[model samples]
Target: MDLQQMRYVVAVAETASFTRAAERCHVVQSALSHQVARLEKELGARLFERTSRRVRLTAAGEAFLPAARQALEAAERARAEVAAASGEIRGRLTVGSIPTVTAVDLPAVLRDYRGRYPQVRISLRAGSSERLVDMVRDGTLDAAFLGVPPGFRIQGVHDRELAHGQHVAVVAPDHPLAAEHEVDLRHLAEEAFVDFADGSAARAQSDQAFAAAGLRREVAFEVSGVELMARMVRHGLGVALLPATFAAELHGLRCVPITNGPVRVERLVWSRFTPSPAASAFLALLGVGAPPTAE
Candidate 1:
């Protein structure tokens, strides 16, 4: 019957649990449940089948879900478009990035954004690319920097290559492999290594390379950030395979090239849902969004 009710229903459908949906909508569970119940009564159709273990949408709710989502997105688009027309952009923009992502010129971009739109609040969160992509898809992040393999595709977001570079192996200067300018994949099979957690973009490259070479190194330590990995390698915890940018400022580490290694591609990904005013401004600043037309 109203936008809020539709949003309640959509959130419920997306999350499958009334409590989680309520949390996502920033409403108490009781309030959200009351609205959904009211919506069902108004429509004279049961929306969800509730059970102790899980929630399932009835036929009516399943049919209503898409329209509900589209209506919400349409409203958001209209509001954003109107705000754009007034040329007043003041809102919060939340962005996500992989830990110590060097591919994006984030500092320069944020500096320019701040200079241009000081009123816009900006928030940044760092995580793995997989987690970042999930956040963007779930409406938690407006845009994100993700490290993806070349030609990779995912639903529900627009993605483009933000930066590209090669993966390099870095070791402590005194390590046995330090003298070699280029290290073969097979050589590291027996070496102790500091590696990323599973599903990292950098790790993806190494995984494929090692699989092809029929070699697997012992991961002595796992760290979330590349900078931390560099530190670990610097301290002789283990060597690491990381983006070339990680080795840029790392003075005490030896940078060794891997023969025909996986390429590290950083991509900018944003949800296809309607973006807020600040998000539009940020996108336009990056030359991704369309320019404003003269009246």
Candidate 2:
């Protein structure tokens, strides 16, 4: 039916409660319910099964939800494109990045972009490279920064290498290997290590290196954030392998270059389809050319 009715339906479906959806949509509960009921009557189908305890989508609602979201997205894009044609960029820009991003000064870049295009609403998400890549592919993220093992090519998106570097061994000041100027993977493999969660792209960087060197190391502490990993290493709990640039940011730790260490490649990735105006403007700020279209 109408866009307002579609909006109320989508909001109710997402929140699973008419009251909560009304709050989110900034309208009274009665009006929102009236709109949804009118839309349902016009369509001759019940979209939701409403019980006192919970609200769940009915069969028709399940089938209608995706199309409703697509219609809203198309309308937003149309408005944004029109604004862009008038030399005013206005849209929502969602960006994703890994916690240990070092290839670009993200905060500064975001600051500059905000200054240049104050009309655009910006949001940022921190996630693993693997998750971020998936978000970009699914259009949840307008663009993302990712880090993976060297030579690992990302599929189904357009990517550009931002930086390439090796991981260095980090140890507490009192640790045995802290004095070493350089160490190899075999030497570091003997120590307990602090690493990222298993199967993450960050963990894979080190895992592939150790497997290649015929070495296996024990990860005594597994952490999701770089700050936590650095804290664990600083407390002498275990050593860690971190990007040289990132390691330099941690105080009270010794960074020793690794002769045979894992190499990480940082990259920027976006959807293969045409980018939104906000995404295109952000990419241009990063000196990236026009995005490639899907073949």
Return the TM-score for each candidate structure: 0.69, 0.91
Kindly provide the TM-score of model 1 when superposed on the true structure, using C-alpha atoms. Answer: 0.69
| The candidate that achieves the highest TM-score relative to the unseen native structure | 2
Q: Report the lDDT tens digits of candidate 1 across residue range 188-253.
A: 777888888767665776787787777777888877777788788888888887787856667788
lDDT of 2 by residue, 168-194 (tens): 999999998988889988888889999
Which regions in candidate 2 have their CA more than 4 angstroms from the true location?
none
Go through the candidates in order and give each one's C-alpha lDDT: 0.82, 0.92
Against the true structure, whose lDDT is highest?
Answer: 2
Positional deviation of residue 268's Cα in model 1 after best superposition, in angstroms: 0.5
Query: Would you list the clashing residue pairs of candidate 2?
Result: none
Give the range where candidate 2 is weakest over 10 consecutive residues by summed lDDT: 286-295
